[model samples]
Target: MAARRITQETFDAVVQENVDEFGLDPAEALAEAVEQFESQGVDLTNIVKAVQSGASEDAKDNQTHTVLQILESLRGHVGTANVDGMPADLKRFTEQCKLGFAQRYLAAQKDAYPTILACCRKVDGEKASLLAALDALSSLTDGQPDLLDAGGREFLMGILREHPDDPAVTVLAVRAVRHCCVKHEQNRQDLVKAGVLPLLTATVSRYSAQPELLCEACAALRVMTFDDDIRVPFGQAHDHAKMIVLENSGLKVLIEAAKAHPDNTSVLSELCGTLSRLAVRNEFCQDIVDLGGLTFMMSLLADSLDHQDLVKQVLSALRAMAGNDDVKDAIVSAGGAELIVMAMNRHIGNAHVCEHGCASLSVLALRKPNNCRVIADSGGLLVALQAMKAHPKALNVQKQACMVLRNLVSRTQELCPVILELGAEPLIRQALASHQDCGDLAQAALRDLGCEVELRELWTGKKGSLTQ
Candidate 1:
């Protein structure tokens, strides 16, 4: 049988029934009625005009709900429909409703925050409602974190604590925490006070097989660890914030998540990012090596040439881990050195890749003369020179490149003439003049070239200033 045509009277009756019998809010009842009418192939223009006119007292009392109803209707009309072919009037109405709802929602957040928190607190057995509320809160709080006050933070934490076994609720709750804590120091401190780190670790460990939950948990941990305010003074705790994560067994859980989902680039990226941050400390550097992090990072670099971001992160972690001679040699044994040089030459214009690549080479060169010889034979020096000339403004690249040259020339004298012949003097001088941090290292490299007389003249612009 053909669907019955829904007239204005039929629509109004459904709305009245919903409001009188079910106690549905007037706007919500109207939205439901509109959904039913659309299902029956009724013309929506009449309902749209009626809602927009604001003629009814109920509509006037709940303007936000009315706007939300229209927004939902507009969304339904456009759902799975080719937007490029949408009617002009319908498209215009949809855009207008969306903008209006956004303005109203932002304006109402000051009053809505506490109400949302209260709703969250009362969601005991209503998992669907709880998920809906959390999703809305996540959208509402994006780039508007101040709306999540201390109480709001507490409510989110409570959800995580109360629904520890529910993957859906845990994922949503962790997502909310991630959004709220990113770039917000006070919120991060609040989460720390709530002992969210251990909770995150436990969630990650418990839900390793659940990729969605693992992704969210890893994202939350990534943001929490990246906050600068959480970092302790250098010698006081030496990567104190990362130390907290390590203490909570965060690395172990992250590695397991990565291993569990080897095909998941997102999980791997976040996992690599967290490891890169933690590897800044020497103690965690060894921990990463022990956890097979070096091999994992090398595999990411070798296998996933398409993922530049992941490769960059992997290089960063390697740069940090290479601070240790043993790990440095391990990177070489794992073919990590060749991969670094390949990434540098491939992404020559990328300042970050060049900087970390050179930094890693510099670390590998230190105290290991044979590694310096290997880098030079692999055309690593040429790549460093190209990086220096390509990105003259990148101070770290210039510094690390100069350090690599300095170490390579100091250990292997035959390479000195080759470096000077490659127009090394001018690049070194340019680096010396432009970057104060690079001057000492660049100057030392110039000295290692056995050009003390030329260096004195370059420094004084006159002859006979050398001290024999």
Candidate 2:
């Protein structure tokens, strides 16, 4: 076997020995050490390959050891080190990690991640110890997902299995799982394959009344359904969402959990957003309604009209659910049109709520002339136009508002004059001019509303034209 290179500690000792015993200067000793290693094909590329006076070197090294110092207490259980202090050490490390990204980076550089993972393994069965370790692992892997290797990933899942009923431990562990799989597609795929979705759904079921636990668990489930990893060409976000809904019964679980926290706006917002993510198919859209999700959203919207964040998420969920043609009818039939208009008018300045609100109207009006008339009667068309005027710079709001207008006038042509009189032409023209992507929709809205539009002639009917 080829000889392995020496460790940094060994190399440093040699350098010190060269300086003290052989009377060589620090720089000379460093150079000699480099030459000696390279001559033997030691490949010192990973080595720092630098030397400094002992005192100054140690001072510089100590600056990054604050994290590691705490782990020392949990390093050896049988020795003078107290195993009972493992939780405190882990918590202290977690707090240090929370100080900022700089501390986490320092810890990673000092090999603190493996040490923490080892500490977690050492205090495997203890509740407090596992919570502290998982918390530390979560913070340490916040922006540094690559640190969660395959073993660490399994360790987290194992802990979840061991403490299936423990809220505190599960929360901390799922948070760590979320941090690892967020931007890392590999970990997400691995975890999902290892059966993480069912555990997440079970968390919602077992702790339906626990708002904090529900939010944390829901957030983890949502992260698993994300396509945020830019490194991959395509993500299985849709597939994962389907698995959660179909294979794991995630939709029913979430809707049931949502009922437990009607007053907690934060949990409701998270639940609605996750529900939106899981609305991947027409049947799923219908399932949300069948599971009483539609009624829940309508009630939430009607009750929490003053809550802007919850309103936005509820509108977005309604928009996602409206993809089903039948649900469109259901939304209009259940007085959703009026409630949505009220929500939008109340939060007109919030571009997000208005954007989702108009899009929901647009979807609801698609191929449903009766829904269009309902919207017209409920002043949905007027609110959409107002949304367009309010968020002129928001391209999504502009595009979605244009779409709703087009759908509204598609069959209900009599309402065309009403929209035109409301000064929609200029805004449609502005949207067409400002956002390049609104080309077809803006012109279509203008045309369907009985207005003149710029028509580009693509075929000159000339010989040798490239249009052919």
Candidate 3:
């Protein structure tokens, strides 16, 4: 009950004592020590019991365990091996690369991407082999987006097109598409143009019961709407998001599909995040409210107060939707203000929830004076200050907490002295001094809170300076 734990050193000492002092055999001594620890109620979950080390560790046989060898073997197997049975080698290769970041990167460096893609194409009709190959492709493309070229994009769309109804195949292929699109703007535009959007919305519609498939599809859809590629001068992120919402009926499909997975925290989290990203335009923000997303998310946040992940996403959606003034008033009217504070207090240690919770409160308090008072009345100020203290190193938390304080005191100036008395000035100054991005927002928060802060001016109306 109290962790009932034993260190490996202590356990090994007892085992050695049995071997040397009691004159027992090594194997028998190990067994005796295990039995003795179990009999005394010691938990051995963390202790590494005796086991043979992996061959990769041995300097004697490095090439035998290398992923490169496995990739070559897989390529040969897929090229000639019969597809009548499950490709055991392909499955093994995928399993090896699935968990290790370095392994996947190494595999990608060995040109494993093309091999895996070709295998997926070759194993088209074989469901088991196709799944294994797709899993392998997903792993190879995890952090190696540069490996994904136009051919790989075509192959991904082909898979989705060929196996639209098969959740097993579509899920893996959609995931491969997601891994390809992240931080790769050209791929995002190419896949969306290649008709990946409707296929994704259709996947959600066809397989709402399969939460795993829906999660992948949702995540993929969200990826297509990203402008993460900094090298590109312009990105089609906004256009892709609009297509998902306007052309593909993403809102209705997602909101309808959401009905099937209310009890699942992970799926709900993804769906909330996708909806937030889609809330870019005013009418789009209103569309989320019109399509029952707002009410559903409020209910989600209220129902799943104890779930940290869900709360964080729900608060994010709320914050995004509040970009519309009417939605802002609506959120406060529905008692979302107090739920946010309560959620922050419930999961105070989670920096994500605190950041989103503060951002949501900040947006709600932007121009609405009454909402500001409602948030403050619900201990919003204290919760924010607590987050600033709890996660000092979290720049986003510091920035958003400063933002919430600024917005909270922006309209309702009465609460300024109250927050300052709780020592809000030093934290604001600390955030200001610590983060470069926090300089202006933290200073604005300090200035708005009626504290003494240095506000820099860039223009002093110098003669002929404006022309330059």
Per-candidate TM-scores read 0.68, 0.81, 0.83
lDDT for each residue of candidate 2 in 1-468, tens digit (9 for 90 to 100): 775667656777777778778999888998988888788888564355556332355574442145556655555542444577777777888887887775676577777788778877877867677677788889999888889887898898898898988889889888898899889998899999998989989998998898898998999999988999899999999999999998889999999999988899999999999999999899999999999999989999999999999999998888889999999999999999999999999999989999999988999999999999999899887898899888888999999999999999999899988888888899999999999999999999999998899878777878776665
Q: Which ten residues in a row have the lowest lDDT in candidate 2?
A: 46-55
Clashes per model (N, Cα, C within 3 A): 0, 0, 0
TM-score of 3: 0.83
Clashes counted in candidate 1 amount to 0
Ranking of all candidate structures by their lDDT, best first: 2, 3, 1
Q: Flag clash pairs in model 2.
A: none
Q: In candidate 2, residue 342 scores what lDDT?
A: 98
Comparing 1 with 2 on TM-score, the higher-scoring candidate is: 2
Off by over 4 Å in 1: 1-112, 122-124, 144-147, 227-246, 393-396, 410-414, 431-468
Q: Pick the candidate with the highest TM-score.
A: 3
Question: Candidate 1's residue-wise lDDT over 140-184, tens digit each?
Answer: 455556577878877888888988999998998898898787666
Candidate 3, poorest ten consecutive residues by summed lDDT:
51-60
lDDT per prediction? 0.72, 0.86, 0.84
Candidate 2 overall lDDT versus native? 0.86
Give the TM-score comparing model 2 with the true structure, all chains together. 0.81
